[model samples]
Target: MQVAYDYEYQLAVADYWQGRPTMEPNVWVPSLPLQMTVAVPASNTDLVVSSGGQQELKLAVMEESTEYQHERSNPMEDFEKAARAFEDDLQKMQTKMHLFPPSMKGEELSKYSEPKVVSIGPYHHGKGEAIPQMESTKYAAACHFINESGRSVEEVYGAVFAVADEARRCYDADKLRLLSDNDFKPMMFYDGCFLLQYMLFMCRDNNDEDHPIADLPWVVVDKLMKLMPKPGLDMETFVGRVKQCLQTRRHLKFDPPILDESYKPPHLLGLLRFYIVGSTDSSTTDDGSGQGLSDNAKKVSLSVSVIELAEMGIRLTADKTTAEINKMRVTRGWFTGKLFLPPVSLDDANARFLVNMAAFELCITPDFGEVDDTMSTVCAYLCLLGMVTDNDTDVQELRKKHILQGGGLTNEDALELFTGLEKHLRPGNCYYNTIVAIENYRSDRRLWIKLYRFGYRNQTAIIAVLTTIAGIAGFLGTLKSFQ
Candidate 1:
């Protein structure tokens, strides 16, 4: 006889039997049919059945209960998997070229942040009508680059194709989904070849008359040159030149470390940034600030401008050794203070490169595995410039000291550039250290600064008082002599 119990009721009865205390054998239930026989073992409360029908029903209930429990726990498992995928996506995004930040968007900043002459990476590849015209130039550059490399075009393209998947991940996923592998591989191959050829052409000592990019507009060439590696005679000389360029102080005897052999740059821009900022030491603290500094020290504010620094007997001087941002520092002497800054030429090309570098640093996330704040070296440098430059007078002061070489830009324009950039940049460790050093110097020589300010503000009055006192003293001396 078949039992007319629902699946839920069967499960409930199974659970009740499993939870019950030890019971006598052959426990009969009034709910069962007359032909059905139930045996309950004394050692366990599990239902034991001699009939095949009862046994099959009990096994089905056990399997369903296990499945129900698994389904109940599935939400947490799914959530955990999604979280892992999200983290992985963020990590991949860090290596890609980032778009201009919303905070930095403005007509004044557009010239600096956006690519004007040519687009090197995927972020601005084909957005403009005029941009696609450069595609022919890129193709020519690729042909020339391949010819120079002494490698077959097939081999070169194959190499790029091999890494095309990784390269594709360095862009917005949504934008990339619209592009097929066929379209993407050729873009990578062409872009890579063009950049290599351009850098090689610009970095050479003798300009070849037949170079593919020689006929480009001067404005375009100039902008591209600003981003190219500095010219060196050979590989050894190039390393030395880069090392020398990264050294912050001329006579300080401190040498900036070179990039490690194993450190592969994600792209040409990343390599350029490495050269500009120098390699970050892995020994840096988790916060990306160097060790031995307290939180309070890094939090110190710098409100003094270039003019105010000069008024307080602090002189601004060009480093003259390197243009690396990490080299800025403040030194105090017995009677005066000096702020040493890397001199920069603020032209259109240099301004564009610097602003894009700053924007790139701003896009770097903390999960990128390097010191997040350390990457903001350009931003910190700009913030320092903004802090010191408030008006044309401050810009003039910086120019006078040879710290700022304003190429084609007037004092007002330079002031405006720094003012526009400084508001969006967060100070990095270098800026924090410079400010802390200045604050420390101010604290150490508080009395001297106060006295100097007092004397400076009343210099004419003090001079008059001294002259009158001298006259009175001379008269008293004459009277004493007569007596």
Candidate 2:
């Protein structure tokens, strides 16, 4: 009998050999009378089948294909999972209080960026050697805060616990895996209450006998005061005072607008950043047309130093309109230009405050949509200061214009601080616009600036030449008269 090898026959054969029943009963035979003889040759084995007469049968060898097929999966489901993960990451980035980035992790930068007296959020909490000393203070402040609110401790703590899960999402998951809800809830509650009480203590008169500050150690008070505003000031004045103390404002001539009652901050440091940088609305600059700069406008670059600007007939002045960092701009006249900068007072406290704020900005992901500017307002302001200040002489010039106010920092210190900070700052829209305006002014008066810079550089030689020429003309006139 001759058998044709086909797909069905191959499948049947495979199923029979594998001990699997075939789907078609008629296709498989359980018992068939047959005789088979196998012959082993040098190159291959041969099988001969004989019923009445012997017949030789040859087996065809098949090569296996090296391809594979996987089970089908739902693409939409995978896409949705990926999209959800991406959104979660963005939310975490926006709401989370982040630690200093690797770039800002050196001993010098970390000293200011990390909390020295106390840790406010999960990022720094329980990590520092000195932080444990403030645990008692936090408890005391929480107790005071609860009493001041006229709420029971359980009620206040329950409120924090209710939002505890939401708050936990703001911190890194790896850091929080070891922290249980039992430990985390109290942390948020105590930290929140302590921060509120601290702010209240800073803004109100300190004579209250039951105040948290009264119980705090003198060393702690001194350190805390460095990060806080002076006591006995109203809310607006308190904001301005803190802004000045932190060197957040170019000048404290104008008070910041009162924080809205509806506004909520992520943490204590966030609240301080708000007080320093002001609201996003206040930070947004308005051109005469009430529109922001075009993309092209924000790409402009400025390289001139403060001294070079002065030589080009451009002077630095403090912006008295507002304490917002975005208030920086340049104005031009027919013969001169003026760069208006927000005034700032630099000191140890201010340096710490500024560095922390800059680090906060650095930690924030650009996808947060917190502001239209490409960089944070504080960082942009620092970058602008860095651009104009190259040396101690530039700091002196800034002080002369009252743009740099009196602080514990000397001119050299201020220069070093700005130089250290500006490297970490990316240009924001405000800084870029200021640069655009300055560049435009420089370009418009290119010829005049060039001539002025040349004349200014060679002024002594030019004056000496003029004096010699005058003497030569006078002697020639005298000689002619004698002749």
Residues 393-437 of candidate 2 have per-residue lDDT tens digits of 888888887777776789887887787777766666666566666
- List runs of model 1 lying over 4 Å from the truth: 1-75, 127-130, 206-259, 279-299, 367-373, 459-483
Per-model lDDT = 0.60, 0.60
Residue-level error in angstroms, candidate 1, position 4: 70
Candidate 1 — what's its lDDT? 0.60
RMSD each, Å: 21.8, 22.2
Model 1: weakest 10-residue lDDT segment is: 208-217
lDDT of 1 by residue, 350-453 (tens): 67767877777777653223565467678878888898888888888887888877455788878888999988776666666666666666655668888877
Full-model lDDT, candidate 2: 0.60
Regions of candidate 2 where Cα sits further than 4 Å from its true position: 1-80, 127-129, 205-241, 244-256, 261-264, 278-302, 365-371, 410-412, 462-483
